[model samples]
Target: MIEKDIDVLVGERLAYLRNKKGYTMRKVAEALSIDPSYISRIEKGHIPSIKILQSFAELYEVKLSDLLESGDGVSSIKIEVEYEWFEFVETMK
Candidate 1:
C-alpha cells in the first residue's frame, strides 16, 4: 500500500536524522519521554501517529516536510556515500 511505503520512507528518514545528529535511540526516547522500544519500532517502518511524527520533527529540529521527502531531490546511493565520506573527513580534522 502507498501508506505503507510512506511509513517505510519516513522511518528511513527518522533513522537517518537520528544518526546524522549522533543521537542514540535512548537519547531520543528520553527527550521525547517515550520508551526506547517505541523509537526503535518507528525506525523499523512502523507508522506512528501524526502527533508522534510531529514530536519527532521537533526533536530532530527538522521540518515535517523534510522527514517526508525522498531525500533532497536525489535518491542515489553514490551521492549519499560520497557525501557521507566527505562528512567523515570533516570530522577527522
Candidate 2:
C-alpha cells in the first residue's frame, strides 16, 4: 500500500475505535498530554510517530498492530507487522 493509503486506513480505524469506546477527542488528548487539535489532525489522516500510535493503542486497550494494519482489506503483499506498547506515562527520575 502507498503511504497515503496507510494514513487513511489508520485514521479511519482510530476514529472508529475512539467512537466505539465512547471517547471524545479531548479526553484522549488530555490522557496523552497533547493538544486536542493534534488528535483531530491524526484522525484526518496525519501520520504520527510510532510512539504516539502505540500510546493511543495502549490507552484504548487495543493491539498496536490492529491500529497499524488495515482492518477491512487484504493486501496480497506480505507485510510483516510488529508493535510494542509505549504507553504515555511519566516516571520519576
Candidate 3:
C-alpha cells in the first residue's frame, strides 16, 4: 500500500483507540508530553515518529502493531509486513 494510505489507516486506528480509551487529544498529548496539535495532525494523517508511536502504544496498553493495524479488512500479513518495515526503520535510527 502507499505510504499516505498507511498513514491514514494508522491515524484512523489511533483515533478509534483513543476514543475507546476515553482520552481526549489534549489528554493524550499531555500524557505523551507532545503538543495537542500534534495529536490532531496524527489523526489527520501526519505520520508520527516511531518514538511517539511507541509512547502511544504504551499509554494505550496496546502492542505497537495494534496501532498500525486498520479495522477495515486490512490483511494481517500486510500489517505484519508494514510493522516489520517500521521495526527495521527504528533499528536503523
Candidate 4:
C-alpha cells in the first residue's frame, strides 16, 4: 500500500477507536504525548510522520494491521480489488 492509504486507514481507525473508548481528542492527545491538533489532523488524513503513526498505534493498544483491515474482522484482497475497480471507473467516467 502507498503512504496515502496508510494515512487514511490509520487516521480513520484512530478516530474510531478513540470514540469507541469514550475519549475526547484532547484526552487521546494527552495520552499519546502529541498535540490535540496533530491528533485531529491525523484523524483527518493529513499525513504525519511514521513515528507519529507508531505512537498512535501503541497508545491505542492495537496492531498496525488492525487499523488497516476491516473493523468487522473479515480479511481478504477484496479491498484492493474494489480500489482497482474504483480507479478504473473514475478514469473511464
Candidate 5:
C-alpha cells in the first residue's frame, strides 16, 4: 500500500477502537494528555508517530498490531468479532 492508504487505514482503525470504547476524541486527548485536534487529525489520515500509535493501542487495550492491521474483507470481520467480545467482557466487569 502507498503511504496515504496506510495512513487512512490506521486512522480508520483508531476511530473504530475509540468509538467501540465509547470515547470521544476529547476524552481520548485528555487521557493521552494531547490536544483534541491532534486526535482529529489522526482520524483524518494525518500520520501519527510510533509513540502516539503505541499510546492509542494502550488506551484501547489492544495490541499495536491491531491498530496497524489492514482492513481487507475477512480480517476486518475477525477484528469486529474480536472487538465485540472485548466489549462484552468489559460489560461483564
Candidate 6:
C-alpha cells in the first residue's frame, strides 16, 4: 500500500499547481472532460493510484519527486495545467 503521506503530499501539490495555473475546478474538469468533483477529490487525497500520480507528473511537466516534495530547498515548480494532463488522468482510471 502507498503511504498516507504520499497521497497527502501529491494532493497538496495538485492544489498548489491548480492555483498556480489559474485553473478553477470547472476549467480543470472541462479540460479533462471529467467531473469537477473528481479533481476536487484527488486534490483532497481521496484518490490513490501511482498511475494517477504519474499522469499528474506528466501533466504538470515536473518530476514525480517534485510533485511529492514541497520545494522548500528544492527549486520551485511553476507549471500550466495542460490539456494532455487530463488525457493522462483518464487513462490511469
Top candidate (lDDT): 3
Q: Write down the TM-score of every candidate.
A: 0.71, 0.71, 0.75, 0.63, 0.71, 0.59
Greater lDDT among 1 and 5 belongs to 5
lDDT of 6 by residue, 1-93 (tens): 333454555677788877877879888777666688888998887655666666666666676656754575332443334667556645654
Which portions of model 5 show Cα errors greater than 4 Å? Answer: 1-4, 71-93
Which candidate do you rate higher for lDDT, 2 or 4? Answer: 2
Per-residue CA lDDT of model 5 for 1-81, tens digit only, reads 224465676788889889989999999999999999999999988977777887998999887767655544313522223
Those runs of model 1 whose alpha carbons end farther than 4 Å from true positions after fitting are: 1-4, 73-93
TM-score for candidate 1: 0.71
Maximum-TM-score candidate = 3
Higher-lDDT candidate of 3 and 4: 3
Residue 21's C-alpha lDDT in candidate 2? Answer: 88
- What's model 1's lDDT at 6? 57
lDDT, model 6: 0.66
User: Model 3: per-residue lDDT, tens digit, 1-93?
Assistant: 454467777787788889889999999999999999999999888988888988888898877777665444432324435567867655744
Off by over 4 Å in 6: 1-4, 72-93
> Which of 2 and 6 is the better model by TM-score?
2
Residue 8 of model 6, lDDT score: 56
Segments in model 4 whose C-alpha atoms lie over 4 Å from true places: 1-6, 73-93
Is 3 or 6 the stronger prediction by TM-score?
3
lDDT of each: 0.72, 0.72, 0.77, 0.65, 0.74, 0.66
The digit string of per-residue lDDT tens for model 4 on 20-87 reads 77889999888878789988898887766545655666777775545555656323222333566445
> Ten residues in a row with the worst lDDT in model 4?
73-82
State residue 24's C-alpha deviation in candidate 2, in Å: 0.5
